[model samples]
Target: MSEKTILVWFRNDLRIHDNEILLEAARKADKILPVYCFDPYYFKIAADGTPKTGALRARFLLESVADLRKNLQALGGELIIRIGNPAEVLPQLAEQYTVNEVYHHREVAYEETAISEEVETALWNLRLNLKHFIGHTLYHKEDLPFPIKDIPDSFAIFKKKVERDSNVRPCIGTPESIITPVITDAGELPTLTQLGLDEPVDDPRTRIKFKGGETEGLLRLEEYFANNNQIAPTKGRNGATVDRSSKLSPWLALGCISMRQVYWAVVKHEQANNVHNTGMLELELLWRDYFRFMFKKHGKQYFAADEQTENTSAEKQTLFEKWKTGNTGIPFIDASMHKLNATGYISNFSRQMVAGYLVRDLEVDWKKGAAYFEEKLIDYSPASNWGNWAFVAGLGHDPRDNKYFNLAKQASELDTNSEFISTWLPVEVAV
Candidate 1:
């Protein structure tokens, strides 16, 4: 009898906890091999000629992957690393290990899906199977109230329907131990310099210094829900003001912690504390889910630029440079841009404000802003980042006729003390 060896290809879903592919591989195969490919394509420059991944994000990813390797080693398994195209590397690794099947989490974004298709084609030629698991979203695709095509265009409608009709499944238990065949030469993790990015300098004013991996991700989750650290939003006349509460996004974006894990934690905390303050947190998770599903439904339309948008790209690029470099002369926009450049992150309110300023005020293309966010954000997920940008640009299923933000009005209202502005803006540039 032949051994059923399965190769678990780690992509965004990098953790050992509540991982469907890892667990299924453990059950179905005699020995499972875990692998993460540092696909060089992701490191390449985008159409805008800026890096597809900037230094800060590259650093965070490297940390996350390293943590994953360490966790796997502790579990008595080794993470095989390779710096090449997954489409080519996976097939090569499968043949070398005599793997019968390749298991991975499916992605919904355009380039990701294209890569998956390429890998699928490569695997088929070798007569090996590439099984894709849908585990990234809080609400699983199977559990959705409607099919992907039929999902409500308005997020409010989608959220209301899903909450009424669907249920979030309980998180699967983490494996006690992983059994693996001897891997003599699991490759080395790459450094930031090797990935064509310089080392990131730490900033003292960073709201949160994010570290990657399942261990760190779980610890942050515990700390977030701890009695002393229960996060509550600052209320304004409109509603809860924007803050990057909890700071779990980078981990969540990299799949160090699954959405279901976060969702259930919120549920337990609310139940135990007899408080309902976690609704906004849960809504964030749902918004992430909505974006993923929307990408599945709309394909590249979320990213597409109309003819007029393309023709205006030259003019937009000039203004975009000013906005990108924090030279916009608008105190609020400049401050937020400076923070983003320094720390790969900004508050949701800041993001909306800056994005609205760029698209509506400067009349730059929203796609440019989204592309730069892709390069800079440590927590950048294709669905959420692009979808939110599209929403701000009034291109997505935002039911609002006006997604514009009056930057001056918002700054006056939200930053009444101007402390946030003062902190981020340099003294030389301070208004």
Candidate 2:
């Protein structure tokens, strides 16, 4: 009899730790062919006239894929690397390996789902199955109290219901050994130039230089919660506005670490330290789940601008260019943009401040700002990025139609000493 071969297609979920697809594939298949495809589609130009993946993000992704390959290799498996549409590449792989099924984690975004469908169709034509698993969210979709369509439109209400009715499922353990048939060539990782992009110069001023891979991600996670294993609100030096986040977003965004792994770590820390500081981190994870579910529910509507924001006037366009380039003339807004442009990262508060400034103060199209973010943010995930932007624009699940931030008031409270402002902005641009 032919060996039962299952092809595990790696997407956003890159790590082997606590990954459902890997666990299931290992359990069911006689041999597993791990694959990572650098789809040229993701490297193409977006509607915003920027490459869909920027240099920094592309660098992060390459590192992540390389790390996955290393980990799989350590486990006696090879991560098959290919560059093309998954529909075409996967079908060819299925035939070449005589694979019985293709397994992957399902994505919620329109384009991702479309690609899944295309791959599914292609696999169907070859008389093979494309099995999908849900492993991204902290809470499994099946465990939710309400159905996806019936989830409350208000985040507060949704949060309350989920916190009351649902529990985060325990993580699946990593496989001890993965079995794969030997293959001569698994393909090679691509360079930035090969992806039609220039290498980004490292900016020394950024607070944290994030390296991709599960090893680095797990190390950072431990370092963040090292103090008494307590996850509490952090403060910056001299109480200046700094990103006090765990810095796990880039890894989390790419699925280097599973949400459940992070959640369980927080729970363990909370239990060990006998502290209640798990609320902040858990709440953030819940918000991430909410955004992903919202994308699943609303589909493409999250990308739409409201009637009031339909304008493409030159003045608004000019303001958008300035806002994105860190020349908004408003000190706080400019500083935020500068930080984002320089490092491809910013604090959640800074993101809110800048998004509010763009939508409320500058009155530019929220979609444009979101598109620029899609191009720039190294940690950009479809649901979180677009969902937060929509929330700030008052177009997402919230009680308020529009939320406004007082720029002067925010700067006064967060950057009272202007230290953050000085760090990112030029002397002339500094207030």
Candidate 3:
């Protein structure tokens, strides 16, 4: 909190603007040292034996990190890249620079919080402090009307209470320029294959060009509101077409853009134009915040399936394989699944449909489906991805527990011409 040196560790909150940790470190320090760790654990196998991260996500991450590094450099600071656990790396960096405190955005999930505790312990042993700031959510937890545990059981209740009781704080605390510290090595950025992943394949069927980083994120946001003139994706559980939807998740998941930034942007758009769905976009952000709060309140239990879950069995495995490959015989579900497989992206509407089909229709375990999405989605946020899959499978806080999607009815309503289905699944098959 003084004019001493501070170490700012970059995690998911990659951007410098609206980054409380970076702003505080810059304002209080004579020098700032920023670093990002490509955790080996992330690139390793997942709990379900699936690759923890695939080529698409790994590539997007690299692009995001590179953009962060360039942004920091432009501000006169350099991003020190490393490949290791943050628990080991941060402590060493603190010792190397004699940092007064380590600053970073807080991560609410069990595994991330565990790492935070470990790093805090390691820093305490070195006589340094590990300080965390709120950068992920639109409203900091302290600003919420109720405590995380007291969060409303349903999103409607939660959103209503939050809208009435809470305020979205304006983002305006960043330093104009970062003061650079003397350093010999800035470190190297790793390629996808260098990070133990295969190269990504280009699919001509994919729609949105999902480039990562804050620049792209902000530009895409501007385009969505101004040039694209797109509104709400849809009101139901069907895959949204790319031409009119906002493709902001890929950058958001990487922390290239803050939620508050997006929220305020929508506010401005609504004031300037008569966009009917501006509030709907903010509703999506609220849902994201809900999942994060749920993780905070329930911890690991938020992921435990409440229904009968078949995690491992021959029949389940076969069903999971068929589902993953997008050959489950159901044309609508298959189309959505194929869309997900071919591109590391899918609309929220289709996501629910496919997730529900895997759990209720095919009778496969929800964890398997969730794990596969974790591996595949380019915009995969642990809080959003796992929480949503759980919600679909009736494992999370769903008022309508054990809800099932009528796939045929959903496709008929959303994909009236069967455009989305035929585009993803061209071959006709008997169902």
Evaluated with lDDT, which candidate comes out highest? 1
Q: Write the per-residue lDDT of candidate 2 for residues 1-431, one digit (tens) a residue.
A: 77899999999999989998998999999999999988998899976578988888888899999999999999988999988999999999899989999999999999899999999999999999999899889989999999999988777788889999999889898998999977768999988899999877765566678888888899988987895433455555556644456778899999999898898998888788787765767777877898899899989875454656378888888888888887766777777777777778887777888888898888887888888888788899989888888888877656273222223444445663433454354333323
Q: On residues 1-431, what C-alpha lDDT tens digit does candidate 3 reach at each position?
A: 54588999999988878888888887788999999999888889765666888888888889899999999989888999999998999898887877788888889888789988998998999988888787888888999999887998777788889999999999856678888678778899998877888776666666666877888888888888876447744343445333345678888888898899998898888777755567657767888898899888889888565657456878878888888887787776777777777678887878888888888887787777888898889899989988888887767766363222223344445553333455354333336
Instruction: Give candidate 2 misplaced runs (Cα > 4 Å).
Output: 228-231, 234-241, 303-305, 399-409, 416-431
Judge candidate 1 against the unseen true structure and give its global Cα lDDT, from 0 to 1.
Answer: 0.84
Error of 1 at 125 (Å): 0.6
Task: Tell me the tens digit of each residue's lDDT in model 1 across 99-139.
Answer: 99999999999999999999999999999989999989999
| By lDDT: ranked, best first | 1, 2, 3
TM-score of each: 0.92, 0.93, 0.91
Model 2 residue 64 lDDT score: 94
In TM-score terms, candidate 2 sits at: 0.93
Candidate 1 Cα errors over 4 Å, as ranges: 46-49, 227-230, 234-244, 303-307, 311-315, 399-409, 416-431
Model 1 clash pairs are none
TM-score preference between candidates 2 and 3, better one: 2
Clash statistics: count for each candidate = 0, 0, 2
Which number leads on TM-score?
2
| Alpha-carbon RMSD, candidate 1 | 3.8
